[model samples]
Target: MGEQRKVLVTGASRGIGRAICNRLHADGYAVVGIARTRPADLPEGMDFHCADLSSAEDLRGLLKKLAAQGPYHGLVNNVGLVQSDPLADVLLEDLHRAVALNLEAAILCAQALIGGMREAGFGRIVNISSRAALGKQSRTIYSATKAGVIGMTRTWALEFAAQGVTVNAVAPGPIATEFFWDANPDRDATTAKLLAAIPVGRIGEPDDVANAVAYLLDRRTGFVTGQTHFVCGGMTVGAA
Candidate 1:
């Protein structure tokens, strides 16, 4: 078994983030979870540090302190927020919040952690993107910010690749998570369409995405940097 590797997962209170933590922990990684709220119950030996990713100062402070205390072997950027308003109707505050939480904070965290990772000569940075970032509609604000994340993934993949650090992105289409309902309280009808569109004919679960993340972090997948893997039941292929 590999020695317990150090990993830091953002937005790990619940849903996909929580699942990712569980997966890595089982694989013998020392996992630290960060979120606005702490989960009621997590695996034993798990460490959690709560912080608001939307705040610039909070983002910088938390990441710097964490890096000082750790030569983290892995970083998972899973924290994100969405705005349900149309381009013609989005508010400035919501737009700022979307970009801040989804893209800006992620970039800052990497800036603070990448140096340590490089010095350690090994690191795994997984940017949790969305198929919505690839090509979608009516999500102008959320899409723009998410698309930036994909770009960041590609750029950093190259920068970290030769340094023994692997940077990749996993864009999940739609999984049944608390954030989904929070974004669309009346979006249940989209389920049938989603399942029909997915070749698998089933909506995804947290574990499904978590499994994909685990694979990308595999030692053998080191050569797989700068690639965005879609864990959306082949949504990247087509809806048909």
Candidate 2:
């Protein structure tokens, strides 16, 4: 074998991000995971970097450090902010925060990393989106931010296609991660309603989304770009 390809994953301490880190590393990528908190049980074959991704200055500093260290050919923009507020009750501060982390941060990271990828003449960018991007109750800002991610994915894919880079989005639906449990602690009638709608009749796992991302990141899949893969247990298929 040769040297393992390097990948940078954001929000990678747990949940879907952590799963992506594991999956990519298993696929022979040198995985560097960035998150606010370092995982005590870090996965094998992965390195961890602790940073507040939502902070522009901190992200810039992290990028500078990574730049000085080496180039990263693969990037997973898995950092996001999910806020639950009705449209009428949405706060500007909440919207700003969501956009800053969910949308702006991804753009900034891409901007910072694309140079190294350009030099390498190969890259893969996977943005973690959500089914909520399609629309959801009490997800005004969250929906907007995720939708923005999709838009950026498409534009970046187009811009980088000629340079051997692919950009895509993975929109997960009703995954059983910590974020899901925390958001639906009661698991009441609303939970039942959600389950009833999923055609698969179960919550999705983090690995489900990770698998889709792994596909997009594969070296053989360079021709596939600007696509939004929905790993939503058929939830995006409509009454299935």
Candidate 3:
């Protein structure tokens, strides 16, 4: 594959982002991976770009470089941050940072490469959100940011529909990744409660979410934009 078939994925060093990169690469697309730290075990054929997405200036500069590369075939906004803080104790800085990294970065990154997609008349954009966006006790800011991502996904889908560009969102729930373990430690009652609430009776793997993203990015799914694909293992079926 060449630049015409290139796909950019942020937060590609770990978790769902890494899985998406691998899946797209396996599907014969040139993968461009972005993250603050480069992973030692990134898959072959995947190019890495290191940058802190939380910094607006840094993210803009990175996008500029990516734009210079020309016409990405796909974009996966899988970079995000989650913080568990009660409403009263939540810091303004935390909220601002969450909005910047989780929401703003995705929008800016999309704007950076959408022009080429428009000219080429084909593109796939996937924004990774969280089931917590529905509502969660301690994830107020995080949920808000993810919810904002959903809104942008819908709007972009409409804006680019006629241009042959599709925009959609994937919301994962209770995925068993390093980020989950680091945020909610094992042996905690809250963790147990979350597990019990999952109708699957098991935690989801990063590949579960990755597979859904791959489907949406497929050329066959060009008619499936402006929708939120919940990779939540049936957790969103009822009041869990």
Candidate 4:
């Protein structure tokens, strides 16, 4: 590659975010990783930033710094907060938290970076949505916000098409990240039930999702915009 194109990835401390950073860096992109805390094992030469995306003050400050340092060529909105609660028991506070991190942060980040992209006439944005957006029990808030992400992706894709930018989403089904293990602890009935619902027979991995994000963020992918690619092992269609 000539000069390395710069990309920003949120929730980059571990799991899918970390995998994306590693893959992009290996692919010769200048990767900037953002998360609430720094990871000790971040790839050498990769930049890391800490910011609580849910906090408006923190996000504003971080965005300002990133703008000054950026003109970044790509962005991966991967930070998300999931509050799994039944509709009857859902808390308003959890809903707000989910909206702030899962929805608002992505919108604001794109708004902050789109101007530079417009000027440069090149950019890629990949939002990490969820298969649950299709409708899952106890995912009311998450589904709503993720669905909103898809809406934003489509709208932004249309708005930015003429400007040489593309916006898309990667909706992952069940991935075996720390969050997944935490939510589905013991290899018990719940875990078995969940596994039975996946056509692939095994849960997905972080790299599986990272690969999808990389494809969407590739410069050559400009024509593939406003689409939601589900990396759900066929769960989106139906169980095997």
List runs of model 2 lying over 4 Å from the truth: 1-4, 238-240
Angstrom error of the Cα, residue 122, model 3: value is: 0.7
**Tens digit of per-residue lDDT, candidate 3, span 1-240:** 388889999999998899888889898989999999999988876899999988888989889988887898899999999888999999999999898889988988998999999999999999999888899898889889999999999999999999999999999999989889987888999999888888877899999998999999888888899999898878888743
- Please tell me which predicted candidate would have the highest lDDT against the true structure: 3
Error of 2 at 79 (Å): 1.0
Best candidate according to TM-score: 3
Which scores higher on lDDT, 3 or 4? Answer: 3
What's the residue-level lDDT of 15 in candidate 2?
A: 95
Could you tell me the lDDT of residue 154 within candidate 4? 96
The reply for model 1, stretches above 4 Å from the true place, is 1-4, 184-188, 238-240
Worst 10 residues of 2 by lDDT: 1-10
Of candidates 3 and 2, the better by TM-score: 3
lDDT of 3 at 219: 80
Candidate models: Cα lDDT each: 0.84, 0.88, 0.90, 0.88
lDDT of 3 at 10: 94
> In candidate 4, what are the lDDT values of residues 1-240, reduced to their tens digit?
233288989999988888899999998999988899999877789989988988878888888888777588899999998778889999899999899999889988998899988988899999999888888888899889998999999999999999999999999999989877776775779878988888878889999999999999988887899999999988888531
How displaced is residue 70 in candidate 1, in Å? 3.1
